[model samples]
Target: MRKYALLISLLIIISAINLNAQDDNEKQLLKQFHSITSEEMSGWLEKLCSPEFNGRLSGTPEFVASAEWVASKLKEWNIKPAGDNNSYFQWFKWPYTIINETGSLTLNLRLSDGSVIRKNYQYPNDFYPGMNSGSGEITAEVVFVGFGVTAPELNYDDYKGIDVKGKIVLMNRDVPHTDPRNPEYKKWVAYCYHQYKLENAVRHGAAGMLYVDGASANPNITYDPSIIVCGIGPQPLEDIFAGIKTTNKALIEKIRASFKPASFNTGKVMTIKANTTRVNEGRACNVIGYIEGTDPVLKNEVILIGGHLDAVGNAGRVVNGALDNGSGVVDIMGAAKALAQSEIKTKRSIAFIFIGGEEVGLIGSKVYTANPSFPVGKSVVFINLDMVGNGTGFYVSAGSSYKEYLKYFEQANAKYIHRPMRTAAPEAGEYYGRPRSDEVVFRTAGFRTMAMWTTEATKKVYYHLPGDDTDAVTIDIMEDVAKMIYLALTEMANDPEIKF
Candidate 1:
């Protein structure tokens, strides 16, 4: 009698737990289905992007801790690791570091007679170290390398016959210019100059580059505000100057003789007596976890949802990013939990991948596509959420092949979601070429992918700044977005009838 009672009690407890889980997932009004409200997202973002999380600097102790927390949460939601390795995080490395500087640079000029003259500046106060990586101190003559280019297209080769192998190359900015579509200024080929410069500089073994102002042909041309100013690395700066057609190029070229050939022992180098580190070795990682499928035929196929979970941490720690990404992060986590409780059994697998090293470039996602935990070709769709906005309607831009599925998603959002989320046929520009998020990586590999964003230039001012904290996110908005995402996932996951 005692044994039977114990068995009955155990069965009762198991049934109660299952019932509670079902209750949590039951669909309801605006406030009901999204038990994981925007409030929860905001709250989680507040905690994760908080100073206590040490800004979640990628690769730091804080970053690792954050990863652990995320993985733990996924496990709690009952999601299982699908990788053969049995781990969710596919870790990769990239060269990186926090900026630490001491002072300005001094140029020691030595005449043919061996006599030396010392010239130095008080740092950015006088001059700034161009984003070129540092090399040890050197003393050599400087040469004017026009535009620092080596483009064979326009028959331009600034590095031609120039032995910039060890000496510094003095070059002008993009072009001397007054025209965006200037033919002479190489507007068409203008954008290639920056990369051409770096590639040529690295190829010819140039020590460094110095951009003496007055390069622009336009004397009044100030820095371009349209250019992004993120702290990740050189991309932001390059993007800013990419549009700079001319900056008094003639003046910069003329100043070549006046560079005063001093020895630059500036920045972190061997003789500078400071520590210098590089992302000397780093790889990308696609943070991954999945809720499995139940259908026999589609069980092997997978549906992956992802986000570039990295940022340029230089935006004040306070840009603790309540919205930039903390909101997205919270969105994924909350969705994982809610879906785990859904009575709907997916016919195909569903993966939630958070990628790292996005801010530095598309480093993480690119790697994941190249080496995915699951087969990339078998993937039916890649859903990416980046910088979603408050309760306002949203937009989804998908691959050329996924137009039909995109319509379905739009319909679902319209039906259950209070916010208006629109869908567009995948094309270029806003949907494609732009390097806004990790979706590009999957798309490049020929996977059917869709990017859902609040739409750039449409977000709050704090979107990319340090002020992007939890206080700015509305829980109600999150709930709505969550419902839409949940609805789409369920429809796609269970619909064995879904085709390209």
Candidate 2:
């Protein structure tokens, strides 16, 4: 009887200890998740989209307003400013923008029958000038240079017989620049063709370029309008997108009905006018904030989380960026806020970076790296949230460089709520689509990074058009994602050995 009583007492003691541990863990989790609330996240989104911000396109008044709001948010958090400006704003200089005004080139065709309806390829439906392509029209022979790739190493030259010098070179998209018949050559016949076709045509004194049909047709297709994102010096995105197009059925119909394709003044000499607007002088800003850690020894080191804060302007507005980054922004914001309010005080810093100019190719992040206030090399891990805020479609988790990190995230998810997240091997994931975001620049700079995105909201729409707005975001999913990230951060921050 005495022994039995002793066993009961021991059982009671064990139960008490287990209960206390569970309570401690609960307190820690609650502490990590309460800083940034759903209510606050909504407010941030509303402020970012407010009329005062004007869509936040870089170099625009709206962009300035957006910058102020972001800075204010950080200031409110009491996070130390990282920029030299004594404020949270980090500005990068960009030059040029499209000076847009309606103008056209009249095409007068010289048919085999002798006369022509047009002299030069004109405006609107005929062709839209390239993004930042210098404005002017050209009247010259149109030579079909198939893809225009100029890889001499491949031994494939589409311009072999034609001296397109002083003429307009026309090409296809993504074809190989070199000959595919070589033992070393395989795919990309069309891609290679265009590599040097335009430049070669220019070098040969060719007036300009005309690339027809990149893929199929979609009227909803957004064109590049910003020259700043392209770069300074010379080459601009506008030049690249200018001649690119989908030889849609509409083009054929337009030609067949009003004009003849043969009337391109093909062999006939004519005049061309071209015009393009460049950004010339402008500024791009990156948004940054931080959640301070309690540990003195590890407080300086950081785990940065964020997404590109900029998008391509489409339909008079930059990329809606709803799924591409809006979702990601929310995810990170949610995580950061939760951590800030969480009771899990530990070592290591938590920085939230919302970069600008990611659409143009991670330019904002690149600028940040070039002159980072923090030791960028010490940024051991970057959790890039790109396209994640859908209604939970294909989870499409990619990035093998951080598989261990992903596993850690999944483990946290399992412990917290959801089952295993849908994921893929990096190679197989490449088959879907290999697009870029600011995270690419981070990895390129020797930082261990992984980006999270999904094709879910993408498949249903809202990828990059005006349709990509805050309305499509799923706050519940965002909350869960935030929880997963926070839990991971807590585990990583508390572990003394996790840091290299």
Candidate 3:
């Protein structure tokens, strides 16, 4: 009986020790969580938006400088390098284009009295100079080519019965089969690229292109010295259909309903002029660093978190991408610093990637996926953050098939940072549509992927525009996101049997 009593007392003492250890861990986590502040995040954002970085366009000297700055911070925080040759960068060849100055777009109206009335549109609002246009001007009649697709196998061709030779062709972005889950959308995916559209327009003998992409700056188009291009806004589009009996909206709807072509001549003469230079030998890189885990066996498994650090550069003027991705980069930086400073050690490795060349294309992600620092099969999951700094609440999305991976972030947000959160698990068919984000590249490479997005934005978003400065971001939310990621990622990495 005395021996039994002794055993019971020892068990009680062990329980008390475990409880105290848990308390200590909680204290340490809270310390790091509170260390993330809005002021610090704002300061980091300001530096990214500074004029010296030249808007952080990849394949430029300014972009390389910005990447080096980020790598220096990782070194300061003691995050070990996991890139090529034990350095912090994975290099790749990324040819880029520079728009020299704001170009001009004029609409010519021919009157019955043998006089022409010319209307010149304003910069950025009515028209955006093409990022990859040739250094010349073209004057031709406008031909409306719907979506600019020609899939002979699918029995569809937008350029059929249309004479666009030596003419300016106005085209939309994507194919007509809008539903992504129908499985037919995948067939049209090859034609959904901006590069493909530009090339198709060139192949059709068009002299120039007026892309109808919301008049926003797009750097994803291919560079061809034979053609000049520009993005047109609502004013110009409306003017193109001024006297037509049917509206542009009606024509698109009719085309979608019956897989037929609605090509026509707008009878409008327009002039597009651009001055640009293309550098074929430009190069870019991805900034990569990792925190090695303590456990011998579990350390092989890695959790990757990344955000793009490249913006649209300057379209005659600097497009400071503060809210576009500066917020995401700084948010990850905050989490990285806290993780490196924490006393507690995770069982699985954690990697922080500041992806480059995302604006021109998904080049950075492609490079990393092609030659991963760690084995791709050993990666547990990838978390991507883009434009996550201008909202009232939080939103998390993952493939609906993988509810286990989603729970880690969901539980973290629910337990600690109790903001209005919405979680989505979109099906694989509906989720993986276009190759738009970095997550797409990772997902296509068979890596489990999830993304964090902000909801209910409080301010106007200046996507790929000059207004996307530090003021466009909500610093408070960014701080919270950093804290949340810091807590969740550490906990996830420490788990020995994390199911994907």
Top candidate by TM-score: 3
Tens-place lDDT digits, model 1, residues 239-351:
22333443233334443434222222221111111122334443435568998888777978888887656544431133355565666677777677677777666788889
Q: In model 1, which regions exceed 4 Å deviation? A: 1-32, 52-58, 101-148, 158-199, 202-276, 279-284, 315-322, 428-436, 456-476
Please write out the lDDT profile of model 2 over residues 234-322, one tens digit for every residue: 12112322344533234334433542231122343434454545565767778777766678767777777777665544323333555
TM-score of each prediction: 0.67, 0.72, 0.96
Lowest-sum lDDT 10-residue window in model 2: 226-235
Q: How many clashes show up per model?
A: 29, 71, 0
| lDDT digits (tens) for residues 455-483 of candidate 3 | 99999999998889999999999998998
For model 2, the superposed segments whose C-alpha errors exceed 4 Å read: 1-18, 31-43, 46-56, 59-61, 99-129, 139-141, 158-168, 175-207, 211-276, 314-318, 391-401, 424-435, 462-464, 471-476
Better model by lDDT: candidate 1 vs candidate 2: 1
lDDT of 3: 0.89
Q: lDDT of all predictions, in order shown?
A: 0.56, 0.56, 0.89
